[model samples]
Target: MPVLAQDAPIRVGGTLPLTGPLAGVGAIHKLAAEVFVERVNARGGILGRKLEYVLLDDQSQPANARTLYERLVTADNVDLLMGPYGTSSIIAAMGVAQRYNKLLVQSSLGDPSLAPYDMQFPALPIGAEPQITDTEVLLDAYAGMATPPKTIAFVTSKFPSALTIAKGGQEVAAARGLETVLSLEYEFGTKDLGAIANRIKAADPDILWSGAVGMEAVQLLDAMARIEYKPKRHFYLFPAPGPTAAHPHAEGLTTLTWFEEHEPFLANAGAADFVAAYNERAKAVGFPYPHAEYQAAAEYAAWQILAAAAEGAGKLDDAAMAEWLRANTVQTALGPRTFEGKFNAGKASTKLKQVQNKQWVTVWPADLRPSGSQFVAP
Candidate 1:
């Protein structure tokens, strides 16, 4: 712990997808970060110094995120760095962090295998092998049902992380003795899913794993409804939580989640307060689905990890902070996280959440679910 000559506000810089396709979910991260920073400052800040976050709009562009990170490090000279949302933007930010040897704590990075930087830590808890681990977790939940899916279909976007996870899932499904009825890959930004929806309807597998992001899942479901076809079971990779829950076709829709607005998750220290604060802030901004979920939990956890590392090391040194995180577990809003595994990832704490009764709730892993909440097989 080195003493500073003078007390100054610690500036942390990062980018968010403020205006683009991913803007809907991106807004949740921004609001969560804002609430975390405000609470940190209210509690005498990190290391007894005020914390200032310099967030820039990446406009959902990976190229812009790369450039903005370079500016944050070189020109702006921010004391520390936070990672941007999404896999592509996070990868771009990781490149800049590696170049400058800055410690980056990110939340929504989809693929951990692509991250080779030792200074970067993830708060998502998808584990080192998310492609394998996440897939297994999802399948494990499905297998516990009274009627497990025997055949599966995969409709994935060409996006890097989603594609990687979907491919891994296909392999896992094969090993688990499930038949693959249909496997299709589409362009990332394809708007009209009528053709794809018709193809899926024809195949009609027992379960459909949609490697979709943002509103893609909703659009696909809408297309399916037009043809009066629906799968027995469906899961989304990273759909917009609010819109998906509100959708008329979203009942029994399952997705990956680390936290939800429920008993066990809210029981974690500071979780309830954070959720309440985030809800108030979100409502003030006229944001829909103001409840804190996995995305918001992950973002707040990133701040928790960074702050814990800084306080644990008693300094703002990037190397020290990284080492602290690597050595110990930080209890985040989601749960405890450690950066000790492959690619500096924590344990795979990914849980399966489903849209039941027009709300997202943890329905799998029986113990985590609220009383009377069980998997609703369609």
Candidate 2:
């Protein structure tokens, strides 16, 4: 390998939904990425060169993401690319990365199957088949209850990833002998959830599975509250952590998580420090939920993977970085992640978390739960 000049900073460019529907959670990713870069540069940077992150707002639009990422690669001439926040945007960025044969380390892509690009690597630990693996994890937690749910009602978003996961959950429920009383699908950005809430209240199943993202979960819960209908139990697929936790109806609201600001998870190398840094940054910006959770952890982990690949390869070469990531496990805030599976995905280390006492905490998989935390019956 030829020696590269250290006078210039290595730029990593990407997009985030900083000012749109997904902005709430996208802010978490943005803050986390900022902290990661700050810490990395403070520690002498990557391969002795300073690290620079070039971020653009996609406004939660896939088409905007496609255009912005093209600008990052062609116009700005970024040396590396970081993947965007949502599934649709990530897919758009992936196309640009594939075209340029660059390594894309992404955090929040909902659907993994859509990523056919070999250079793309996922930082979220949802595994290659989250539709099956994630559903199984949730159902497994439910099964540990004294009286397991016998019937379920699924309210899904027509968003590509949510639809796929919701349909897969129905199959997994049937296989587990859980009857589906009612299943509903609505447009991705539906605001008025009254009619859907009314129908769900009418069905009144043992558990309600909502494939909601961003503020959709809060909207559904509020609509249900208006109708005086609260299911015995409920699970949200990809909710915005802060908003969902702050909602009054979100207590005991279950969701999937790979990291939480608690023991075991915080025991990972640099996890506690990252949490402290994120809390300070989030609080400084007047963020509602100032605690570090799965979203922040995943975003930090994505940066960790990129840095690890670059350092391990001893350069900022895209192919060399991807090769290094495939050959070794990167220690991340979510723990050690190995990109050995399909599309450079790691194992499905999904854990169940819930809002307890207005805080998101891991409660399932007894062993990984906080000292006194246990799965609360909803």
Residue 130 lDDT in candidate 2:
85
Candidate 1 residues 203-254, lDDT tens each? Answer: 8998899999988888998999999988899999999898889888889989
Off by over 4 Å in 2: 1-5
Q: What are the Cα lDDT values of the candidates?
A: 0.90, 0.91
So what's the TM-score on candidate 2? Answer: 0.97
lDDT of 1 at 184: 96
Q: Which candidate is the best by TM-score?
A: 2
How well does each candidate superpose onto the true structure, as a TM-score?
Answer: 0.97, 0.97
Clashing pairs in 2: none
Q: Report the CA-based lDDT of candidate 1 relative to the real structure.
A: 0.90
How much is 297 displaced in model 2, in angstroms?
A: 0.5
